[model samples]
Target: MPTQHKNIVLLIADDLGKYMGSYGCPSISTPNLDRLADSGTRFDMAFASTASCSGSRSTIYTGLHTHENGQYGLNWARSHFQTFQYVDSAPKLFNQAGYRSGIIGKVHVGTEEVYCWQVREESGTRDVAWVADRCEAFFQQATVDDKPFFLTVGYIDPHRDISTRGGFGNQERQYGTRVPLLDVKPEDVEIPRWLTDLPETRQELVEYYKAINRTDTGVGLVYEALERQGLLDSTLVMFTSDNGPPFVNSKTTLYDAGIHLPLIVRQPGAKAGIVNPNMISFVDILPTLLDWASIPLDARSSDKDSRLPTSPPRQGRSFLPILQRTDLLPESDWQHHVFGSHTFHEMQNYWPTRILRTRRYKYHRNVAWRLDFPFAGDLYASITFEGIRNVEPPVMMGQRKLKDYIFRPPEELYDLDADPDEVSNLAGEEACESLLLNCRERVTEWQKQTKDLWLYRDGQSVTMLGRYAKDGLQVPERLDFDVENPGTKGVEMTKHLGVDAYSAGIER
Candidate 1:
């Protein structure tokens, strides 16, 4: 039988940010990833919807935010937050299209029924070579059956090891007798702008780089496997990470370093070796895959009888059209803005943040501004944090003060064009008031659309209130109360349905 659709091989790296040779980081060695980027379209502005492990992966699988999907925190260590049973996942979608969907290594997303992979090989070791070997076997089997496979190879590389001993677990003998070709020296480590350059940081970075190099080698092996099985041209190969590195100011935070991922997609018959700068979210991944497989969007949802009323529909559109474009589109021609939400990383790290990022501005609405921000388990025990805490008089992490990082304002706005590092807060500035308000409104509208639970302030959920009947009055089309000052009037909506009326009167 002739192949009807292209196969999908998604290689996901754990805790890896955009710090590779293809992304213009010279110190790190990622030859396989660079080659893949050269043979595909490298997305410069791809971002994860959430920064935590299970939350980010859940977004990729279900095309819904953490708030809607219910995988709000880590999946292991007694923090077993599983996705809602009614939610449709990626493997289930691909399976419906008659493809054998399988996953190898690092299954953090959730329950067996929700993920439903046809072939599941969960690995605890961080050995990329071993993972590549297993993937090769899977590719060979798929070749035998002539099945269009949707294989997701999750590499546990580049993430911190099980201990605070600063090892990335790249031991060669643990996987096999194979030796790693790429090795990074401590002195050659290029420190990220958000991290302080110290001996411990450099040393740990070396291990991280080694793990990344191992992952790259694994990628090369998988590519070769596909080639050997005559599936290279018929495969849509995508390589990306779950979130940013395991470090302070990156992993669990909604900062650019945390959510900004490295995405390279080599579509079956599209133009290759192009750098696409379009802003895409992780939520778009499932839809894009469905589109590529010629599956209907409605195919992902549950049957009409079993659908949950509170479960919001998928909020992402496919970017497959952008991939087919021969000429580069302008920034305005693509998605102008992307939204992000992070409710928790670990069970205790409950700092719910919502962000709306445009080309020039970023607005972060911290829901729990009064509480001290908690840290992830790995980040708190990291050697980098040790170095930062050892300094006298308490030095700040990156450009943020210790207290400021813990106790943040309710809102934060940054001009990305002027302050790319997000060091300046323009939320309170008089000149940026209108822009801030507009961004805030956009975020609030998005929250309402997604039915976010964090849209509440001061023990009152404006979103929830807007949905119910009040004093026999029809529900307002929009909630116009100021988020910063809950009692103040911002924009008032009329009681008449379909009338876009606004009044400067406070109802409360």
Candidate 2:
């Protein structure tokens, strides 16, 4: 590692929450991560743009909201899932800045864009042994070559299959782990009330803990590699997740459990023990890393190029100043609001949704079809079919049920201060007049500014007219549907959610 450029290593786990030993989750053995936390700042108020893998990762890479990045769905090939080649994705910028960049494990960035990188195929967040070895090898090579590397290592343990909940899928295999049984009973796990209380959910939480532990062990390998190469002090390490855990309303919703993620950044030669509570978005990552590495903004920089022509809004400010001095920027100075949306696993044809979050208030705009069409089928079984022959195709087909789950009318809202779970809808509450008004205004402004169909205020007319016209009745200048790739129909469905909502006059 060279002293001129700070080495960057980002470790991201799938579907992790603040349920780690470092964050005061007792019984979970996350020693390696705990050690990292003990030596760096653990952010308590960081958030992902969306809880789903693709949405969150896209937001992190583009330094833009999921809506802005055009990745509201699980798959790519739609206009919304378009890769941010011209934006502030860390890998793109880092590679252009003369740094060797690579990724290991699961990457939600679109397949089209990822072909340029050296990537590993294993997906999920769990105790995969091979991931650690590959990561260590990458670190060693980077060190040997004296390169300031931007390497992203993803872990898929503690996710689905190998779950503790009465075993993963139908195989019923209990996953072994080092974590102890805490006071956390299965009933104590806070999640959507719609899900049934079962042994599976309980064991699933334990499996998640085990997966976290394994991820930490992998982290330790990289840390040891850095130490062996005598580059510990020259590297800046970051640990976080794609989204919230994969239980209940956590992973796919706009509630705190879904979007609020953990972020820990350890810089070289800096204070060892510190905590910064500044509210930051995943989009701010690129600018922060670039600033840390002292990389100047050139023509290739998203910030630099966008300034020349029309500039869409960049939803987050750089964290560099806050990193230098925790008090330099107040939490409010960092953001007025955060936005999120989800259209993945579109049961009833890709449930489209948009959300807004302030410090204490949160609002959701559901632009999907009605929610009562049908409950999704048994797609959860795929987690257990791992390593089985002929399972891949069936698993993939079963996932389509996730896309068939019914959706409901185009609008919803919640005040997180009073309803952290976002269970109650305040969209029609007269008492919340002021909050609703402000939220609607903000969302409309953002939609118009971002050229989304969600700018429409009439939910009824748009839906009726869209249905009548047979070509989505789009709100003028709002989000429109465009199929960028022919094979992926899901992308088109997700992209049309906002347009349909706007056309339906769903806005408050």
Q: In angstroms, how far off is 169's CA in candidate 1? A: 0.9
Can you write out model 2's per-residue Cα lDDT over 110-225, one digit (the tens) per residue? 64453245444445534344566677787777766777788888776445553232232223333344322223345444323333334454555544555566667777877877
lDDT of each: 0.80, 0.60
Which portions of model 2 miss their true places by more than 4 Å? 1-4, 76-88, 112-115, 118-129, 162-197, 296-313, 324-332, 346-349, 372-410, 460-508
Look at candidate 1 and tell me the lDDT of residue 189: 92
Per-prediction TM-score: 0.90, 0.74
Query: Best-fitting candidate, measured by TM-score?
Result: 1
Q: lDDT tens digits, residues 39-116, model 1?
A: 888988888988998899999989899987889888887887889776788887788778988999989988888899
Please give the TM-score that candidate 2 achieves against the real structure.
0.74
